[model samples]
Target: MTQPEVEPVSPRPSNLNLPNVLTTLRIVLVPFFGAALLVDGGDSGTWRTVAWVIFFVAMATDKIDGDIARARNLVTDFGKIADPIADKAITGMAFIGLSIVGEVWWWVTILVLLREWSVTLLRLSVLKRVVIAAADLGKLKTTVQGLALGLLVLPLLDPDLPSWLETPGEVLFYVAQVLLAVAVALTLWSGAEFYRGVWRQRHELRGSGKS
Candidate 1:
């Protein structure tokens, strides 16, 4: 017997949605955030506070956009492409700007950026072939990185802050540094895990092809 015709799949959601708008907004904010962070050679408490607020807003939108997209079934190719790029652009600016201001080591920023971009590019290249889900370690890395960067963006060591804040601010700065160190470790580990996952999936595909 002949089989019945299958219904056509629904078209993808439009790219011009709130989620995408938020993602684009995050990208647009990168330069402004960097400029604020670098004001007065990174010594302006007020500007640093402004930078921190921008960063926080950008990061908040990152989560908000993703949640909105998923909840409303508004996922699209544009979001798939722009979401990660937006994230990297903002965080990359923070890293580079921090290094420029001597808040973070140059080597650390270089290493993290290299890994982040390389992995992002590779993932996008294989987007059609591989469906590697975000691993727990990767999520942890993201969380730690965001927390560390956010804390560092504040003018915790600005020297011009209130005397009462000196001790607490100093403590927070050191804690942020420690979190950054942990984030670096997690970043490397997650990168390696991602590569291994890609390799295993490709190997399985090859093996199946031979059969």
Candidate 2:
């Protein structure tokens, strides 16, 4: 008896879904955010605040896009690729810009950047065999880092704020400092988690191999 031919599966297209739109929006905002931060070379309070708003909006998309994709079953290969790229672009811009403005130490920025990109590359290496979803600790790290960077970017939070807000702003700045330290620590921890996961799945990954 002759065997029947098997049909090939077609990949799902990454249409203009809400989640993908949000992801694209985040990527698009990266350069604008960088420009707003640097227009006055991080000196002008107005531009600094503008940059903060832009950064907040971009980060908000990060929080929502994943939820929307999962809830609506709108996940796509494009999203899988573009989402992380968008994140890295915006967050990397923030780190580098802060370092430029003297708000963040270069060493801290370098350490976080190295870990983030290195882990991302590691994930890609095993993409065919496994998909690593973001962990709770990773989410927390991002949240803390975003808040910390926002505080650092808000130039008006210092002596420029009204007396009523100045005290609160100063307090928040100090809080941001603590959060940043915690964020860095969490970053390293989550990266360790990723490697541990990969180690645990080594046998499965080897079996899966390449297509």
Candidate 3:
């Protein structure tokens, strides 16, 4: 893997590349996901299933692109920026959409959203000076969220999920909640660690001062 000299992942894949395109497609689907939930006029209701499936597929792309990029060594500068944006758009909309529909409390939605947006901005700030990619915790959080969101949307797809598994909605919701909580903790921890790394390296940079 050829690393960027100054910035490890600098000049990452461009927005027009395959992975980034997938990310943009996912972001574009957020509104449709919300609309499929909020507004229903028979046919609109049918679209809910499609929306849910699409949501999961979109989320799947997130997982796929990263793996492909890393395994195939196709990671791009644009992927770095676009991937997280896709994540926030999808998650923020779902959380807020559920709140708007009175499914989950707005407070919960806000909490999740605040963590997501804050961490995103934090990454932007930290990445400007340092080169920290997504960490284990962040990945864990995304897994939980994607599963939770998929399950939550599943109900919309099929209100009666396999007669045996009762209370699937609540089950998935709580599971996702737990995962998100863990994710939040990790996000905060990673953010702190990133800053600490930056702080420690500040003097080292001054000593070298190679541009």
Candidate 4:
């Protein structure tokens, strides 16, 4: 008896879904967020606060869109690509804006951005051949980075604030700096791990092919 023919499975069509919309919205907000942060040379307390709110909203949408996509099975290629780009764009803006304002050092921003974009590009390049899930270290790095950036985005240390707030604001500012240090360390470590995973996986794939 002859076996029946099997149809090759076609790729699912990308839809104009809520997750993709949110991802696009995030990218659109990046320039606005940067503008708000840089207003008055990042010295205006009001504008700083506004920028913080915008950053918060953008980050919130990042989480919400991922959750909704996973829950509703709305994941698509666009979401996978655009989502990370949107994330890096907003965070990159924050890092550059903060450095411009003298809140963060130029070297720190340069190192972090280099690591971030390098990792992002490498991952995208090998995405078709290898899949690496988010590790706990990466999650921790993101959380710390976001908290540090968000706190620094606030006008906490602005000298124009009330005298009563001066001490607390300074304290918070230092705290944020400490968190940023930790975040940078985590970022480098996670990047190393990711590269190692890719190397190991590719080696294993080559070994299997040889067999």
Candidate 5:
């Protein structure tokens, strides 16, 4: 018997919805990635390398999924919401795991995670009334985060990696650290703009008796 065909998540219809599948894959991989981090604890080279490879692939998926979704017109509310949540989970868990192993600066992880959570809350509070899509700065922030996380993850499991141009981990660490700081700034700025938009939307709607 032919099975029932399920509808895709996006309101826009397209068979080339690669982004949705990639986002789904990222969600599925988060737990395994966490487990790998635990197993690679205490700076074990082999396990760290394995963890990094998996993380790299997962991070790559983050970019690919979004691009595919946009290109294929499969941008759904589900993808809009869940994709960022999945990113934070994977990145946040690794940040915490890396700190636990004393590989990353604990304060750095705390600061970054705080920014992530704050911006997430701000977006959630306003997503319903406004389209809180990624601004250019936010997209740049994600790129910065992907690079920084890669550097951070590598050192946690394998310290031999030279992050930027031709520098060692120590040098690359600070560079990625700076980029993370910048990303946080961008996140906050963009978030505030989004909040203002939502506030305006709500006020206007209420004035029109639409709310």
Candidate 6:
């Protein structure tokens, strides 16, 4: 008699874990950060500084959550989906707020957001067919954007700050501009790379009649 075939079992996804909790916390902070920025009305004051602190903390959670998830083997489908959404929300708020407050140009915000969302949409479209992990270039892009936006969000330009800080802050702002430009370049480049990888995988699957 022939033996019965056994089906492979998938790992059960863990949702309620430390990483997911941190991820949720990051999402929750988004509104408060926006409120602070709006309340400050782009002025260099306590509220504006508070907003930056909120933003920084939120960003920090991103790194911590990912590390904890990987280290603890607590990765889940929910986390995979929620993490990117949270990231987009926080970063999107920063971009839009800066544009509204006349701190950053609208065009730059528009271009960066367009690329960011396009890549995200691509990921969703191919999620079933391929698992494309983030590339080094993608992480680099994120880091650069974080640094650039963090610097821009700071009220270091405020005259109330010490005279010494004003000069350094101005210099940091200029450096942030350069980083932003680099980030935009990497964003477009990495996006193209992702598309190429997806196309190749899809093509292979099609050739093998698995797609």
After superposition, candidate 4 runs with Cα above 4 Å error: 1-13
Model 4, 1-211: lDDT tens digits are: 9999999986674669998999999999999999999999999999999999999999999999999999988889888889889999999999999999999999999999999999888888887888888899998999999999999999988989999999999999999999999999999999999999989999998989931
Could you tell me which 10 consecutive residues in candidate 6 have the lowest summed lDDT?
Answer: 38-47
| Candidate topping TM-score | 1
lDDT of 5 by residue, 1-211 (tens): 9999999775555433667678778878877766776773545655665667878888888888877777867777777777888788878877888778775678878887887887787777667765656678777777777777677666432544444533565676677767767766766776667567678878888999978
Candidates sorted on lDDT, descending: 1, 4, 6, 2, 5, 3
Tell me how far the alpha carbon of residue 185 in candidate 5 is from the true structure, in angstroms, after superposition: 3.2
Clashing pairs in 2: none
TM-scores of all candidate predictions against the true structure: 0.95, 0.87, 0.72, 0.93, 0.75, 0.91
Candidate 2 vs candidate 4: the lDDT winner is: 4
Off by over 4 Å in 1: 1-8
Winner by lDDT: 1
Top-down TM-score ranking: 1, 4, 6, 2, 5, 3
For residue 187, give model 6's deviation from the true position in Å.
1.1
The C-alpha lDDT values of all candidates are 0.95, 0.86, 0.68, 0.93, 0.72, 0.87
Task: List, residue by residue over 8-72, the lDDT tens digit for candidate 6.
Answer: 98677579999999899989999888888877577856778888999999999999999998887
Stretches off by above 4 angstroms in model 5 are: 1-17, 121-126, 156-167
Report the lDDT tens digits of candidate 2 across residue range 81-180.
Answer: 7888899889999999988988789999999999999887788777767778788888888888888887888884545667898878788878888888
Model 3 over residues 79-123: C-alpha lDDT tens digits? 777788888898787777666655556776776677678768777
Candidate 2 matches the true fold with a TM-score of: 0.87
**TM-score of model 4 relative to the true fold?**
0.93
Q: Pairing residues by index, what is the TM-score of model 6? A: 0.91
